[model samples]
Target: MDLQLQGKVAIVTGASKGIGFYTALQLVKEGAHVTICARGEKYLEVAAASIKQQTGADVLAVPADVTKEQDCQAVIEKTIAHYGKLDILVNNAGTAAAHPFEQVATALWQTDLDVKLFGAIHCAKYAIPHMKQAGGGSIVNITAVLAKTPPASSLPTTVSRAAGLALTKAMSNDLGAYNIRVNAVCIGLIRSDQIEKCWQAQAPQLSWEEYSEQVGQSIPLGRIGSTEEAANVITFLVSDAASYVTGTTVNIDGGAGSAL
Candidate 1:
Protein backbone atom coordinates (compact mmCIF):
# COMPACT_ATOMS: atom_id res chain seq x y z
CA MET A 1 0.00 0.00 0.00
CA ASP A 2 2.57 2.44 -1.09
CA LEU A 3 1.08 5.94 -1.26
CA GLN A 4 3.90 6.97 -3.62
CA LEU A 5 4.34 10.08 -1.44
CA GLN A 6 8.07 10.01 -0.77
CA GLY A 7 9.72 13.44 -0.89
CA LYS A 8 6.49 15.26 -1.73
CA VAL A 9 6.28 18.73 -0.23
CA ALA A 10 3.12 19.72 1.64
CA ILE A 11 1.72 22.59 3.71
CA VAL A 12 -0.89 21.97 6.40
CA THR A 13 -2.56 24.86 8.24
CA GLY A 14 -3.64 24.93 11.90
CA ALA A 15 -1.22 22.10 12.58
CA SER A 16 -0.38 23.18 16.12
CA LYS A 17 -2.68 20.50 17.43
CA GLY A 18 -5.59 18.16 16.79
CA ILE A 19 -6.52 16.92 13.32
CA GLY A 20 -4.11 19.25 11.55
CA PHE A 21 -1.18 18.04 13.61
CA TYR A 22 -2.15 14.43 13.03
CA THR A 23 -2.50 14.97 9.30
CA ALA A 24 0.95 16.51 9.05
CA LEU A 25 2.41 13.74 11.15
CA GLN A 26 0.87 11.05 8.97
CA LEU A 27 2.14 12.74 5.82
CA VAL A 28 5.63 12.63 7.23
CA LYS A 29 5.14 8.98 8.11
CA GLU A 30 4.28 8.34 4.47
CA GLY A 31 7.60 9.99 3.54
CA ALA A 32 6.54 13.55 2.73
CA HIS A 33 8.24 16.77 3.76
CA VAL A 34 5.64 18.86 5.59
CA THR A 35 5.41 22.51 6.58
CA ILE A 36 2.94 22.96 9.41
CA CYS A 37 1.56 26.37 10.41
CA ALA A 38 -0.61 27.88 13.15
CA ARG A 39 -1.17 31.21 14.87
CA GLY A 40 0.32 29.98 18.12
CA GLU A 41 4.10 30.01 17.90
CA LYS A 42 4.69 27.99 21.05
CA TYR A 43 2.42 25.13 20.11
CA LEU A 44 3.63 25.17 16.51
CA GLU A 45 7.24 24.79 17.58
CA VAL A 46 6.39 22.02 20.00
CA ALA A 47 4.33 20.16 17.40
CA ALA A 48 7.13 20.37 14.83
CA ALA A 49 9.65 19.12 17.34
CA SER A 50 7.44 16.19 18.30
CA ILE A 51 6.78 15.27 14.68
CA LYS A 52 10.47 15.39 13.88
CA GLN A 53 11.33 13.29 16.88
CA GLN A 54 8.64 10.73 16.16
CA THR A 55 8.93 10.43 12.37
CA GLY A 56 12.49 11.63 11.72
CA ALA A 57 11.01 13.51 8.73
CA ASP A 58 11.71 17.02 7.55
CA VAL A 59 9.19 19.19 9.40
CA LEU A 60 9.08 22.99 9.36
CA ALA A 61 6.92 24.89 11.82
CA VAL A 62 5.61 28.27 10.74
CA PRO A 63 3.50 30.51 12.97
CA ALA A 64 0.94 32.39 10.89
CA ASP A 65 -2.66 33.42 11.22
CA VAL A 66 -4.68 31.97 8.34
CA THR A 67 -7.21 34.82 8.47
CA LYS A 68 -4.67 37.32 7.17
CA GLU A 69 -3.65 37.38 3.50
CA GLN A 70 -0.08 38.30 4.38
CA ASP A 71 0.19 35.38 6.76
CA CYS A 72 -1.09 32.91 4.19
CA GLN A 73 1.34 34.29 1.64
CA ALA A 74 4.17 33.98 4.10
CA VAL A 75 3.30 30.34 4.72
CA ILE A 76 3.54 29.53 1.03
CA GLU A 77 6.68 31.61 0.61
CA LYS A 78 8.45 29.91 3.47
CA THR A 79 7.37 26.46 2.34
CA ILE A 80 8.80 26.97 -1.14
CA ALA A 81 11.94 28.55 0.26
CA HIS A 82 12.49 25.50 2.44
CA TYR A 83 11.34 22.67 0.19
CA GLY A 84 11.67 24.21 -3.32
CA LYS A 85 8.29 22.81 -4.49
CA LEU A 86 4.74 22.27 -3.30
CA ASP A 87 2.76 19.06 -3.78
CA ILE A 88 -0.11 19.29 -1.32
CA LEU A 89 -2.01 22.02 0.53
CA VAL A 90 -4.37 21.12 3.36
CA ASN A 91 -6.55 24.05 4.39
CA ASN A 92 -7.51 23.05 7.93
CA ALA A 93 -7.35 26.35 9.75
CA GLY A 94 -10.46 27.73 11.50
CA THR A 95 -13.33 26.55 13.64
CA ALA A 96 -16.56 28.49 13.99
CA ALA A 97 -18.72 28.53 17.11
CA ALA A 98 -22.27 27.26 16.76
CA HIS A 99 -25.14 29.72 17.24
CA PRO A 100 -28.65 30.30 16.02
CA PHE A 101 -29.17 32.66 13.13
CA GLU A 102 -30.85 35.27 15.26
CA GLN A 103 -28.11 35.10 17.85
CA VAL A 104 -25.27 35.23 15.33
CA ALA A 105 -23.61 38.62 15.34
CA THR A 106 -22.39 40.36 12.16
CA ALA A 107 -18.90 40.43 13.61
CA LEU A 108 -18.99 36.71 14.22
CA TRP A 109 -20.15 35.91 10.69
CA GLN A 110 -17.43 38.08 9.15
CA THR A 111 -14.73 36.58 11.32
CA ASP A 112 -15.78 33.04 10.49
CA LEU A 113 -15.66 33.76 6.77
CA ASP A 114 -12.31 35.43 7.14
CA VAL A 115 -10.71 32.43 8.81
CA LYS A 116 -12.35 29.55 6.92
CA LEU A 117 -13.24 30.77 3.45
CA PHE A 118 -10.79 33.59 2.84
CA GLY A 119 -8.04 31.64 4.52
CA ALA A 120 -8.33 28.84 1.95
CA ILE A 121 -8.60 31.35 -0.85
CA HIS A 122 -5.40 33.10 0.14
CA CYS A 123 -3.45 29.86 0.50
CA ALA A 124 -4.69 28.43 -2.79
CA LYS A 125 -4.04 31.71 -4.54
CA TYR A 126 -0.36 31.46 -3.73
CA ALA A 127 0.04 27.68 -3.79
CA ILE A 128 -1.61 27.18 -7.18
CA PRO A 129 1.29 28.73 -9.03
CA HIS A 130 3.79 26.46 -7.38
CA MET A 131 1.51 23.49 -7.96
CA LYS A 132 1.22 24.42 -11.57
CA GLN A 133 4.94 24.87 -11.85
CA ALA A 134 5.45 21.48 -10.27
CA GLY A 135 3.10 20.03 -12.96
CA GLY A 136 0.36 18.99 -10.49
CA GLY A 137 -0.74 18.96 -6.83
CA SER A 138 -3.50 18.05 -4.41
CA ILE A 139 -5.56 20.39 -2.23
CA VAL A 140 -7.77 19.12 0.55
CA ASN A 141 -10.12 21.38 2.48
CA ILE A 142 -11.11 20.15 5.96
CA THR A 143 -14.78 21.04 6.08
CA ALA A 144 -17.56 19.56 8.22
CA VAL A 145 -20.67 17.39 7.87
CA LEU A 146 -22.75 20.46 8.61
CA ALA A 147 -21.90 21.71 5.14
CA LYS A 148 -24.33 19.21 3.64
CA THR A 149 -26.73 18.64 6.54
CA PRO A 150 -27.28 21.79 8.53
CA PRO A 151 -28.67 21.08 12.00
CA ALA A 152 -30.58 23.72 13.95
CA SER A 153 -28.50 26.36 15.78
CA SER A 154 -25.50 25.73 13.48
CA LEU A 155 -24.99 29.11 11.91
CA PRO A 156 -21.68 30.42 10.58
CA THR A 157 -19.91 27.03 10.54
CA THR A 158 -22.47 25.43 8.27
CA VAL A 159 -22.52 28.42 5.95
CA SER A 160 -18.75 28.67 5.90
CA ARG A 161 -18.28 24.96 5.22
CA ALA A 162 -20.80 25.02 2.41
CA ALA A 163 -18.69 27.72 0.82
CA GLY A 164 -15.63 25.52 1.29
CA LEU A 165 -17.31 22.62 -0.47
CA ALA A 166 -18.25 24.87 -3.34
CA LEU A 167 -14.70 26.14 -3.49
CA THR A 168 -13.40 22.59 -3.66
CA LYS A 169 -15.61 21.77 -6.62
CA ALA A 170 -14.87 25.00 -8.43
CA MET A 171 -11.14 24.67 -7.95
CA SER A 172 -11.17 21.12 -9.20
CA ASN A 173 -12.82 22.21 -12.42
CA ASP A 174 -10.50 25.17 -12.92
CA LEU A 175 -7.32 23.31 -12.05
CA GLY A 176 -7.95 20.01 -13.76
CA ALA A 177 -6.38 21.33 -16.89
CA TYR A 178 -3.22 21.94 -14.94
CA ASN A 179 -3.35 18.41 -13.49
CA ILE A 180 -4.17 19.79 -10.04
CA ARG A 181 -6.71 17.86 -7.97
CA VAL A 182 -8.98 19.44 -5.35
CA ASN A 183 -11.18 17.69 -2.80
CA ALA A 184 -12.61 18.02 0.73
CA VAL A 185 -13.14 15.91 3.85
CA CYS A 186 -16.30 16.68 5.82
CA ILE A 187 -15.74 16.02 9.52
CA GLY A 188 -18.12 15.01 12.31
CA LEU A 189 -17.56 14.62 16.08
CA ILE A 190 -13.87 13.75 16.20
CA ARG A 191 -11.87 13.96 19.42
CA SER A 192 -9.75 17.10 19.45
CA ASP A 193 -8.51 19.80 21.84
CA GLN A 194 -11.37 22.12 20.93
CA ILE A 195 -14.00 19.44 21.47
CA GLU A 196 -12.38 18.46 24.76
CA LYS A 197 -12.34 22.09 25.90
CA CYS A 198 -16.02 22.50 25.08
CA TRP A 199 -16.88 19.29 26.89
CA GLN A 200 -14.91 20.33 29.99
CA ALA A 201 -16.43 23.81 30.03
CA GLN A 202 -19.98 22.51 29.69
CA ALA A 203 -19.76 19.29 31.69
CA PRO A 204 -17.09 19.64 34.32
CA GLN A 205 -18.20 16.47 36.07
CA LEU A 206 -17.86 14.14 33.03
CA SER A 207 -14.53 12.47 32.30
CA TRP A 208 -13.38 12.38 28.66
CA GLU A 209 -14.19 8.68 28.25
CA GLU A 210 -17.64 9.18 29.80
CA TYR A 211 -18.38 12.25 27.73
CA SER A 212 -17.15 10.58 24.52
CA GLU A 213 -19.40 7.59 25.08
CA GLN A 214 -22.37 9.86 25.73
CA VAL A 215 -21.69 11.81 22.57
CA GLY A 216 -21.05 8.67 20.46
CA GLN A 217 -24.50 7.29 21.24
CA SER A 218 -26.02 9.76 18.82
CA ILE A 219 -23.82 8.60 15.94
CA PRO A 220 -24.69 5.45 14.01
CA LEU A 221 -21.21 3.97 14.29
CA GLY A 222 -21.58 4.19 18.11
CA ARG A 223 -18.30 6.05 18.51
CA ILE A 224 -16.66 9.30 17.48
CA GLY A 225 -13.88 9.38 14.82
CA SER A 226 -10.15 9.55 15.54
CA THR A 227 -7.62 12.05 14.24
CA GLU A 228 -5.69 9.24 12.53
CA GLU A 229 -8.84 8.04 10.78
CA ALA A 230 -9.37 11.44 9.21
CA ALA A 231 -5.67 11.80 8.50
CA ASN A 232 -5.53 8.50 6.63
CA VAL A 233 -8.16 9.67 4.17
CA ILE A 234 -6.42 13.03 3.75
CA THR A 235 -3.04 11.42 3.18
CA PHE A 236 -4.58 9.13 0.60
CA LEU A 237 -6.19 12.06 -1.20
CA VAL A 238 -2.79 13.70 -1.42
CA SER A 239 -1.08 10.59 -2.67
CA ASP A 240 -0.72 9.00 -6.10
CA ALA A 241 -3.23 6.35 -5.05
CA ALA A 242 -5.90 9.05 -5.25
CA SER A 243 -4.66 10.58 -8.46
CA TYR A 244 -8.07 10.14 -10.02
CA VAL A 245 -10.01 11.56 -7.06
CA THR A 246 -11.01 15.22 -7.29
CA GLY A 247 -13.92 17.61 -6.69
CA THR A 248 -15.49 15.14 -4.23
CA THR A 249 -16.43 15.82 -0.60
CA VAL A 250 -15.92 12.66 1.44
CA ASN A 251 -17.62 12.62 4.82
CA ILE A 252 -15.44 11.17 7.58
CA ASP A 253 -18.36 11.21 10.00
CA GLY A 254 -19.28 8.02 11.84
CA GLY A 255 -22.47 7.86 9.77
CA ALA A 256 -23.67 11.04 11.45
CA GLY A 257 -24.33 13.13 8.36
CA SER A 258 -27.71 12.55 6.79
CA ALA A 259 -26.83 13.54 3.25
CA LEU A 260 -24.71 11.54 0.75
Candidate 2:
Protein backbone atom coordinates (compact mmCIF):
# COMPACT_ATOMS: atom_id res chain seq x y z
CA MET A 1 0.00 0.00 0.00
CA ASP A 2 2.25 2.71 -1.25
CA LEU A 3 0.60 6.07 -0.64
CA GLN A 4 2.90 7.65 -3.24
CA LEU A 5 4.02 10.33 -0.71
CA GLN A 6 7.71 9.90 -1.41
CA GLY A 7 9.66 13.19 -1.54
CA LYS A 8 6.64 15.30 -0.66
CA VAL A 9 7.03 18.09 1.92
CA ALA A 10 4.65 18.42 4.87
CA ILE A 11 4.11 20.54 8.00
CA VAL A 12 2.26 19.13 11.00
CA THR A 13 1.20 21.35 13.92
CA GLY A 14 1.16 20.23 17.59
CA ALA A 15 3.64 17.55 16.66
CA SER A 16 5.48 17.36 19.97
CA LYS A 17 3.41 14.38 21.08
CA GLY A 18 0.19 12.46 20.69
CA ILE A 19 -1.69 12.19 17.40
CA GLY A 20 0.28 14.99 15.77
CA PHE A 21 3.58 13.30 16.59
CA TYR A 22 2.37 10.01 15.13
CA THR A 23 1.02 11.73 12.02
CA ALA A 24 4.36 13.38 11.40
CA LEU A 25 6.14 10.12 11.93
CA GLN A 26 3.81 8.35 9.53
CA LEU A 27 4.41 11.00 6.90
CA VAL A 28 8.11 10.46 7.29
CA LYS A 29 7.58 6.75 7.03
CA GLU A 30 5.90 7.33 3.68
CA GLY A 31 9.03 9.24 2.60
CA ALA A 32 7.80 12.78 3.12
CA HIS A 33 10.13 15.45 4.43
CA VAL A 34 8.26 16.67 7.50
CA THR A 35 8.40 19.83 9.59
CA ILE A 36 6.78 19.39 13.01
CA CYS A 37 5.76 22.40 15.11
CA ALA A 38 4.55 22.91 18.67
CA ARG A 39 4.69 25.53 21.44
CA GLY A 40 7.33 23.72 23.46
CA GLU A 41 10.73 23.95 21.81
CA LYS A 42 12.35 21.19 23.85
CA TYR A 43 9.66 18.60 23.17
CA LEU A 44 9.39 19.55 19.51
CA GLU A 45 13.12 19.03 19.04
CA VAL A 46 12.98 15.72 20.82
CA ALA A 47 10.05 14.59 18.71
CA ALA A 48 11.89 15.50 15.54
CA ALA A 49 14.94 13.59 16.67
CA SER A 50 12.87 10.56 17.55
CA ILE A 51 11.08 10.57 14.19
CA LYS A 52 14.36 10.91 12.35
CA GLN A 53 15.84 8.02 14.29
CA GLN A 54 12.83 5.83 13.59
CA THR A 55 12.27 6.63 9.92
CA GLY A 56 15.65 7.93 8.77
CA ALA A 57 13.78 10.74 7.05
CA ASP A 58 14.35 14.49 7.17
CA VAL A 59 12.54 16.08 10.12
CA LEU A 60 12.42 19.75 11.13
CA ALA A 61 11.32 20.84 14.58
CA VAL A 62 9.76 24.31 14.63
CA PRO A 63 8.52 25.76 17.91
CA ALA A 64 5.51 27.89 17.05
CA ASP A 65 2.22 28.47 18.78
CA VAL A 66 -0.54 27.97 16.21
CA THR A 67 -2.84 30.34 18.10
CA LYS A 68 -0.68 33.18 16.74
CA GLU A 69 -1.05 34.08 13.07
CA GLN A 70 2.60 35.06 12.82
CA ASP A 71 3.69 31.70 14.17
CA CYS A 72 1.50 29.91 11.64
CA GLN A 73 3.04 31.93 8.84
CA ALA A 74 6.49 31.17 10.18
CA VAL A 75 5.76 27.47 10.04
CA ILE A 76 4.98 27.61 6.33
CA GLU A 77 7.83 29.99 5.60
CA LYS A 78 10.40 27.81 7.31
CA THR A 79 9.13 24.64 5.67
CA ILE A 80 9.24 26.19 2.24
CA ALA A 81 12.69 27.67 2.89
CA HIS A 82 14.05 24.27 3.79
CA TYR A 83 12.07 21.93 1.57
CA GLY A 84 11.44 24.35 -1.31
CA LYS A 85 7.81 23.22 -1.51
CA LEU A 86 4.79 22.41 0.62
CA ASP A 87 2.61 19.47 -0.33
CA ILE A 88 0.78 18.68 2.90
CA LEU A 89 -0.36 20.73 5.89
CA VAL A 90 -1.76 18.95 8.93
CA ASN A 91 -3.62 21.43 11.17
CA ASN A 92 -3.51 19.30 14.32
CA ALA A 93 -2.84 21.80 17.10
CA GLY A 94 -5.66 21.83 19.68
CA THR A 95 -7.00 20.52 22.98
CA ALA A 96 -10.40 19.48 24.27
CA ALA A 97 -11.61 21.84 27.02
CA ALA A 98 -15.16 21.40 28.19
CA HIS A 99 -17.19 23.41 30.66
CA PRO A 100 -20.87 23.80 31.40
CA PHE A 101 -22.45 26.38 29.09
CA GLU A 102 -23.42 28.57 32.03
CA GLN A 103 -19.89 28.40 33.44
CA VAL A 104 -18.10 29.08 30.15
CA ALA A 105 -16.41 32.46 30.04
CA THR A 106 -15.86 34.65 26.98
CA ALA A 107 -12.13 34.20 27.43
CA LEU A 108 -12.49 30.44 27.42
CA TRP A 109 -14.50 30.47 24.20
CA GLN A 110 -12.04 32.84 22.57
CA THR A 111 -9.11 30.66 23.56
CA ASP A 112 -10.74 27.56 22.12
CA LEU A 113 -11.67 29.33 18.88
CA ASP A 114 -8.19 30.77 18.55
CA VAL A 115 -6.50 27.38 18.72
CA LYS A 116 -8.98 25.25 16.76
CA LEU A 117 -10.70 27.54 14.27
CA PHE A 118 -8.32 30.39 13.58
CA GLY A 119 -5.37 28.07 13.95
CA ALA A 120 -6.54 26.07 10.93
CA ILE A 121 -7.46 29.24 9.06
CA HIS A 122 -4.03 30.81 9.49
CA CYS A 123 -2.18 27.67 8.51
CA ALA A 124 -4.38 27.02 5.48
CA LYS A 125 -4.12 30.65 4.38
CA TYR A 126 -0.35 30.44 4.32
CA ALA A 127 -0.12 26.92 2.94
CA ILE A 128 -2.66 27.30 0.15
CA PRO A 129 -0.64 29.71 -1.91
CA HIS A 130 2.48 27.58 -1.76
CA MET A 131 0.41 24.56 -2.57
CA LYS A 132 -1.10 26.32 -5.54
CA GLN A 133 2.35 27.28 -6.69
CA ALA A 134 3.62 23.77 -6.31
CA GLY A 135 0.61 22.57 -8.37
CA GLY A 136 -1.34 20.74 -5.56
CA GLY A 137 -1.36 19.77 -1.86
CA SER A 138 -3.43 18.37 0.99
CA ILE A 139 -4.70 19.85 4.28
CA VAL A 140 -6.02 17.64 7.07
CA ASN A 141 -7.75 19.25 10.05
CA ILE A 142 -7.84 17.27 13.31
CA THR A 143 -11.23 17.93 14.80
CA ALA A 144 -13.40 15.85 17.17
CA VAL A 145 -16.53 13.70 16.87
CA LEU A 146 -18.22 16.01 19.35
CA ALA A 147 -18.46 18.49 16.50
CA LYS A 148 -21.07 16.28 14.88
CA THR A 149 -22.48 14.60 17.96
CA PRO A 150 -22.52 17.27 20.63
CA PRO A 151 -22.77 16.09 24.21
CA ALA A 152 -23.46 17.90 27.51
CA SER A 153 -20.70 20.00 29.08
CA SER A 154 -18.81 20.21 25.79
CA LEU A 155 -19.32 23.89 25.30
CA PRO A 156 -16.48 25.75 23.57
CA THR A 157 -14.78 22.70 22.09
CA THR A 158 -17.92 21.51 20.39
CA VAL A 159 -18.67 24.90 18.86
CA SER A 160 -15.10 25.45 17.71
CA ARG A 161 -14.75 21.99 16.21
CA ALA A 162 -18.00 22.35 14.31
CA ALA A 163 -16.53 25.51 12.86
CA GLY A 164 -13.42 23.53 11.92
CA LEU A 165 -15.53 21.02 10.02
CA ALA A 166 -17.15 23.85 8.13
CA LEU A 167 -13.73 25.28 7.39
CA THR A 168 -12.66 21.96 5.91
CA LYS A 169 -15.59 21.93 3.52
CA ALA A 170 -15.19 25.59 2.55
CA MET A 171 -11.48 25.25 1.92
CA SER A 172 -12.00 22.10 -0.09
CA ASN A 173 -14.55 23.79 -2.32
CA ASP A 174 -12.49 26.91 -2.91
CA LEU A 175 -9.20 25.10 -3.43
CA GLY A 176 -10.39 22.14 -5.45
CA ALA A 177 -9.66 23.96 -8.67
CA TYR A 178 -6.07 24.41 -7.58
CA ASN A 179 -5.84 20.67 -6.84
CA ILE A 180 -5.53 21.22 -3.07
CA ARG A 181 -7.55 18.73 -1.05
CA VAL A 182 -8.99 19.80 2.30
CA ASN A 183 -10.43 17.24 4.69
CA ALA A 184 -10.85 16.58 8.41
CA VAL A 185 -10.67 13.65 10.80
CA CYS A 186 -13.16 13.74 13.68
CA ILE A 187 -11.72 11.86 16.62
CA GLY A 188 -13.47 10.05 19.48
CA LEU A 189 -11.69 8.33 22.39
CA ILE A 190 -8.13 8.18 21.13
CA ARG A 191 -5.02 7.46 23.16
CA SER A 192 -2.86 10.55 23.45
CA ASP A 193 -0.72 12.54 25.85
CA GLN A 194 -3.49 15.04 26.57
CA ILE A 195 -5.89 12.25 27.52
CA GLU A 196 -3.23 10.75 29.76
CA LYS A 197 -2.72 14.07 31.53
CA CYS A 198 -6.44 14.48 32.07
CA TRP A 199 -6.78 10.98 33.48
CA GLN A 200 -3.82 11.55 35.81
CA ALA A 201 -5.30 14.80 37.10
CA GLN A 202 -8.88 13.59 37.45
CA ALA A 203 -8.25 10.01 38.61
CA PRO A 204 -4.84 9.67 40.16
CA GLN A 205 -5.51 6.09 41.24
CA LEU A 206 -6.26 4.77 37.73
CA SER A 207 -3.41 4.18 35.30
CA TRP A 208 -3.97 5.37 31.73
CA GLU A 209 -4.17 1.79 30.47
CA GLU A 210 -6.93 0.97 32.91
CA TYR A 211 -8.78 4.20 32.26
CA SER A 212 -8.58 3.71 28.49
CA GLU A 213 -9.88 0.16 28.78
CA GLN A 214 -12.86 1.28 30.81
CA VAL A 215 -13.73 3.93 28.25
CA GLY A 216 -13.15 1.60 25.31
CA GLN A 217 -15.69 -0.90 26.51
CA SER A 218 -18.44 1.65 25.90
CA ILE A 219 -17.41 2.23 22.31
CA PRO A 220 -18.89 0.00 19.58
CA LEU A 221 -15.49 -1.31 18.55
CA GLY A 222 -14.83 -2.42 22.12
CA ARG A 223 -11.59 -0.44 22.24
CA ILE A 224 -10.21 3.02 21.95
CA GLY A 225 -8.26 4.24 18.88
CA SER A 226 -4.50 4.57 18.78
CA THR A 227 -2.46 7.53 17.54
CA GLU A 228 -1.19 5.34 14.72
CA GLU A 229 -4.73 4.48 13.72
CA ALA A 230 -5.63 8.14 13.21
CA ALA A 231 -2.28 8.86 11.62
CA ASN A 232 -2.77 6.15 9.00
CA VAL A 233 -5.97 7.77 7.77
CA ILE A 234 -4.39 11.22 7.74
CA THR A 235 -1.38 10.00 5.79
CA PHE A 236 -3.69 8.52 3.16
CA LEU A 237 -5.72 11.72 2.92
CA VAL A 238 -2.53 13.67 2.25
CA SER A 239 -1.20 11.20 -0.24
CA ASP A 240 -1.95 10.62 -3.91
CA ALA A 241 -4.04 7.62 -2.97
CA ALA A 242 -6.94 9.81 -1.86
CA SER A 243 -6.84 11.80 -5.07
CA TYR A 244 -10.60 12.28 -5.19
CA VAL A 245 -11.31 12.76 -1.46
CA THR A 246 -12.13 16.35 -0.55
CA GLY A 247 -14.65 18.46 1.29
CA THR A 248 -15.38 15.50 3.58
CA THR A 249 -15.13 14.61 7.26
CA VAL A 250 -14.04 11.09 8.21
CA ASN A 251 -14.98 9.89 11.70
CA ILE A 252 -12.15 7.92 13.25
CA ASP A 253 -14.17 7.07 16.33
CA GLY A 254 -14.86 3.34 16.72
CA GLY A 255 -18.57 4.09 16.06
CA ALA A 256 -18.69 6.67 18.84
CA GLY A 257 -20.22 9.47 16.80
CA SER A 258 -23.99 9.30 16.47
CA ALA A 259 -24.34 11.48 13.39
CA LEU A 260 -23.58 10.06 9.95
Runs with alpha carbons beyond 4 Å of true place in candidate 1: 198-210
Local distance difference test values of all predictions, in order: 0.93, 0.91
Model 1 TM-score, all chains together: 0.95
Clashing pairs for predicted structure model 2, backbone only: none
Clashing pairs in 1: none
Q: State TM-scores per candidate.
A: 0.95, 0.95
Quote the lDDT for 156 in model 2. 92
Model 2 stretches astray by more than 4 angstroms: 197-211
Q: Give the least accurate 10-residue stretch of model 2, judged by summed lDDT.
A: 206-215
Tens-digit lDDT track for model 1 on 126-178? Answer: 99999999999999999999889898999999999999999999999999999
Give the lDDT of residue 235 in candidate 2. 93
lDDT of 2 by residue, 1-260 (tens): 88999999999999999999999999988889999999999998899889878877669888999899999999999999998999999999997789889999999999999999999999989999999999999999999999997889999999999999999998899999999999999988888777777778877797767777777887898777889999999999999999999999999999978887
